[model samples]
Target: MMESIVDSMLAQETPAPAGNPIESAEELSSIAFGFMASKALFAGLHVDLFTLLADGPKTAEELAKAAGIPLNRIVTLTTALASVGVVSISDRKLIQNSSAAQNFLAKQSKYDFGDYLRYQIDQQMYPFLLQLNAVMKGDLSDDAIASYQHWMADEEQASVYSESQHAGSLGPGRTLARKVDLAKASTLLDVGGGTGAMTISLCNEYPDLHATIIDFPNVAEIGWRFVSEAGLVDRVRYIPGNAVQAQWPGRQDAILMSYLMSGVPGEAVADLLRKAFDALAPGGKLMVHDFMVEEDRRGPALAALWQLQHMAFTPDAHSLSVGWLTEAGRKIGFAVDDVDNLIPAMTKLVVFAKPS
Candidate 1:
């Protein structure tokens, strides 16, 4: 009787839901196993799997040989990628790169973002997130919290971080160039600019504009190479020191603090805003771009996650919000001209203007 009842239940056909599935245990499971998915992507990128599959479909054996990964291991990696929709497998045992992988992950593609993923996520963030438990418990030492700055003091590591970060910053920099108006501005300041990506983008957009970047010595060294490559050396220069401590060129037409405010301590953010206000020329614009939550601080999932991620390195990092930034800029005697998303929900661009 039990077997008959079970068979009857299995045989019953149910209509599929027309819209999104309801929140359930599956959502919880997906969240719990999220790290495994991240690791799978890292592994595939490390092995150059996407590049191998970019040419065309290949059997598991062919991929193994081409990627120089063992057959069994390649199969395992490909299977995981397939499950994540980046790799597809057919009954004939052929594996192919999904459109997402072919366009963004393949080295031959112009939009290849593998470097950012490999360096920032795999090398840096992966290990950093491992200390979340200790960080939350307040068990970490001051040296541990300051480790990121110490690591950046090394030229080699700084180069690696800046190079990958430059790749990630270029798109947003170009976006800023298109969206923000700087036609009247002649000089600009890029505080904490990494690799001068925004400077290059803006310089490319406005032929007559010149800019100065303030960052660490090692980062400036790396950034010079990028500026030279972009052929903007004549227009762009660097001041190698802490941006807060460095002597900023006074009476600037514009100042940009991309990814700057949230990376520093709470007090430092206010100081930077004041410094930008002081440095800008009358009628100059200060563009502040960084991860920021909405006013209520309830959640924009990615912004919240990025704030948490930064905390893995910067224990005293400020919790940024658009409302707070606007209020701070107002307090510093600047008018908030515009506020909009730079990278959708992840970051915002707030333009503050000094009265002419």
Candidate 2:
């Protein structure tokens, strides 16, 4: 009876027109299996495989012995990694990290963000993605990522998330500091500033500048530790509260909202922009950095993917665009001053200014 039911369903399927037949299904197949590649990369990070290869090349047997895994298991892992160009195996059967892996995945490199990849992206977000369908269909509540307060309720988990996120954010923070001119602005507010990474970067760039970060209490605690480490205790401070509802200090010289928009529900975005406009001094700049798709929303796969990923957590998440922000800012009595890519195609920086 089950076989007949299945056959009936299969018989209802239609074939594509011969003229419109696909040249190849390679692209579709690649995307379908993309998760497997990501898992391989995560597995490599979990095993500290990249770090081990950092010291020098090693044979499979040597790696297995060093990592305390069986030889067959190590070989399988290395083969998967090698296929993805993250690592390479030589004719001599010695393995080493690719240059990109050596730079960013190895623990020894100054630019290494291995913790970010291993902890935040892999362990945290990866598992959360499984519940994405539920989130989209509005079937799930008690979301860990969408509701920031709920997620930060646990101090230990918050520390792990923030610390890894800080590692990922610092480099981009420095990039923003260099790209945007905050030289003349002495006061800045970093709203939803995770771990004060952006503030630290800006303060380091401008010695005269002082930054106040508004975030959840647990998040602020972690930010304070990072600020102390950066020796910007005097110049950098935190206000513990929800950024959307908290009373913001008026007449700020500049405001930064990095990775803030897409994380919040769609309706709150306009309010956030309004808040920034209200908070800024005359001619003050508000920089919004987040995953913004192209105005036409055609390509730039990474940006689109990130926005979609955020929707999995944030049930009412808005899909952002340059046009959307410009329209929203204009309605709030602000002029769009500048727009640029902050992280290549993955994120954008849109600067809006209140009239002086």
Q: Local distance difference test, per candidate?
A: 0.84, 0.84
| Tens digit of per-residue lDDT, candidate 1, span 121-224 | 79887788877787888898877775556778977878878888888888888888877899999999999897898899899999989999998899999999
User: What would the per-residue lDDT of candidate 2 be over residues 62-116, giving only the tens digit for each residue?
Assistant: 9998888899999999999899899999999999999879877888876677787
Residue pairs in clash, model 2 = none
lDDT at 7, model 2:
30
Candidate 1 wrongly placed segments (more than 4 Å): 1-23
RMSD of 2: 10.6
- Clashing residue pairs for model 1: none
What's the lDDT of the predicted structure labeled candidate 2?
Answer: 0.84
- The estimated TM-scores of all candidates read 0.91, 0.91
